[model samples]
Target: MKEISPKEVEHMLSDGADMNIIDVREAEEVAEGKIPGAVNIPLGLIEFRKQDLDRSKEYVLVCRSGGRSGRAAEYLEGQGYQVVNMTGGMLAWEGNTE
Candidate 1:
C-alpha cells in the first residue's frame, strides 16, 4: 500500500478529486474527528466487511497516527482493491472535519 499525507488529501479534495476515503480506526477514535465523508469500517472489519466498499473506485485508508489504516490498506490490496494509506492518519489532517 502507498502512503499519502493528509495535507495532500485535503488539496486533492479542494481540486475536486474523486476518492473513496475510509477510516479504519475503531468507532471510538472516530469521535475525535474524521475527515468529512470518510467511511468508518474498523480494521478488524476489513475482511468480511470490505465488500461493502466500492471496488470500482480508488480508496484511501486512515486511522489514528497511521498504524491501523496501514494494515487495512495492505489487506484491501490483497483483496484486489486499489487502496492507499493516509500517512500520519487523522493526526496530520489540516482541513475541516465532522
Candidate 2:
C-alpha cells in the first residue's frame, strides 16, 4: 500500500491542498484530538462505513500508530479505493489538530 509521512501530510495541509484524511482510531482515542478536518472512522467500522467513502477520491488513512491505518489502506485498496497510509500515524504528527 502507498504510504506518506506525517510531516508530508502537515506540509500538504499548510499548503492548502485539498485532501481526504480519515482517522481510523476509535472514538475515545479521537476524543484526545485529531488532524484538522480528519473524519473519524474507527478501524473496526471501516467495512461498514466504507460506503460513505467515494471510490474516486484518494484518502489518507491514520491511526494512533501506523499499523491500523496500514491495514485499513490494504482493505480499501483491495476494494478498489485509492488510499495512502500515513506512516507513524498520530504519534508522529507535529501538525495542528482539532
Candidate 3:
C-alpha cells in the first residue's frame, strides 16, 4: 500500500489539496482531537460505511498509531479505491486539528 508521512499530509492540507482524510480510530478516541477536516470512519465500520467514500478520490487513512490505518488502506486498495496510509498516524501529527 502507498504510504505518506504525517508532515507530508500536513503540508498537503495547508496547500489546500482536495484529498480525503479518514481517521479510523473509534469515536471516543476521536473526541480527543483529529486532523482538521478529517472524517471519522472507525476501522470496524469500514465495510458498512465504505459506500460513503468516493472511489474516484484518493484517501489518506489515519489512526492512533499506523497499524489500523495501514490495514484500512490495504482493504480499500483491494476494493479498488486509491488510498495512502499515513505512516505515523495521530501520535506523530504535529498539525492543526479540530
Candidate 4:
C-alpha cells in the first residue's frame, strides 16, 4: 500500500486528477464533513463492498485519523487494488469538506 499526504491529495483533487477517494470513517463523521466527491464507505463496510470497489484504478482511503485508512489500504493492496493511505487522514486535510 502507498502513503499519500494531505497536501498531495488536496493538490490532486484541485488539479482534477482522475482518482478514487474513499472515506473509511463512520457515517456520522462523514455527515459532519468529507472531501468533495469522496465515497462514504466506512471501514466496517469495506469487506462487503470489495467487489463493488473498482480494482482497475487507484483508491485513496481516509479516516478520522490515519489508523483505519492504513488498515483499509493494506486490505485493498492485498486484494490487488492500487490503494493509498491518506496520511493524517481528515485531520490533516486542507481540502474543503461538506
Candidate 5:
C-alpha cells in the first residue's frame, strides 16, 4: 500500500483531486473532529462496509495515528482497491476539519 503525508493529501484536496478520504476512527474519536470531507468507516467496520467503497475510485485511509489506517490500507489493497494510507494520520493533518 502507498503511504502519503497529511500535507500532501491536503494539497491534493485543495487542487480538487477526486479522491476518497476514509477515516477509520471510532464515532467518539470522530466527534472530536475529522478531515473536512472524510467518510468515517472505522477500522473494525471496514470489512463489513467494504462494499460501500467503489473499486474504481482512489481512496485514502486515515486514523488517529498511522497504525490502523495502515492496516486498513493493506486490507483494501489486498482486495484490489486503489488505496493509500495517510502517514501520521489526523495528528499530522494541518488542513481544515469538521
Candidate 6:
C-alpha cells in the first residue's frame, strides 16, 4: 500500500480531485470530527463493508492516528483495490472537518 500526507490529501480535495476518502475510525470518534466529505467505515467493519468500495476508484484511508488506516490500506491493496494510507490520520490533518 502507498502512503499520502495530510497536506497532499487536503490539497487534492481543495483542487477537486476525483478521489474517495474513507475514515476508518469508529462512530464515536467520527462523531467528534472527520475530514469533510469523508465516508466512515470503522476498521472493525472493513471486511464486511469491503463490497461497498469500488475497486476501480482511488481511495484514501484515515483514522484517529495512522495505524488503523495503514492496516486498512494494506487489506484493500491486497484485495486489488487502489488505496493509500493517509499519514498521521486526523491528528495530522490540517484541512476542514465536519
* Best candidate, TM-score: 2
In model 2, which runs have C-alpha deviations exceeding 4 angstroms?
none
In model 1, pairs of residues that clash are: none
Higher-ranked by TM-score: 1 or 6: 6
Model 5 Cα lDDT, one tens digit per residue, 1-98: 79999999999989998768999999999999999889999899999999988999989999998999999999999999999999999999889999
Candidate 6, residues 1-98, lDDT tens digits: the string is 79999999999889998768999999999999999889999999999999998888999999988999999999989988999999998999888989
Clashes of each: 0, 0, 0, 0, 0, 0
Which candidate ranks first by lDDT, i.e. highest? 2
Clashing residue pairs in candidate 5, if any?
none
**Distance from true position, residue 66, model 5, in Å?**
0.6
Writing each residue's lDDT as its tens digit, candidate 2 over 1-98 gives 99999999999999999999999999999999999999999999999999999999999999999999999999999999999999999999999889
lDDT of each: 0.87, 0.97, 0.94, 0.90, 0.93, 0.93
For model 4, the superposed segments whose C-alpha errors exceed 4 Å read none
Q: State the lDDT of candidate 4 residue by residue for 3-94, as single tens digits.
A: 99999998988898977999999999999999998999989999899998777888889999899999999988988888989999999988
lDDT of 1 by residue, 1-98 (tens): 78899998999988998778999888988988888889898888889897787787789888988988888888889888888899998888889989
Error of 5 at 69 (Å): 0.2
Compose the digit string of candidate 3's lDDT tens values, residues 11-96: 98889997699999999999999998899999999989999999889999999989999999999899999999999889999998
Candidate 5: list runs displaced more than 4 Å.
none
- Please state the error at residue 54 of candidate 3 in Å: 1.0
- Please give the distance, in angstroms, between residue 30's alpha carbon in candidate 3 and its true position after superposition: 0.6
Instruction: Write down the TM-score of every candidate.
Output: 0.93, 0.99, 0.97, 0.96, 0.96, 0.96
Give me the displacement of residue 1 in model 3, in angstroms.
0.3
lDDT comparing candidate 4 with the true structure: 0.90
lDDT ranking of the models: 2, 3, 5, 6, 4, 1
Query: What is the Å distance of residue 5 in model 1 from its true position?
Result: 1.0
Lowest summed lDDT over 10 consecutive residues: which window, candidate 3?
12-21
Candidate 6: RMSD to truth: 0.7
lDDT of 4 at 35: 92
lDDT of 4 at 26: 92
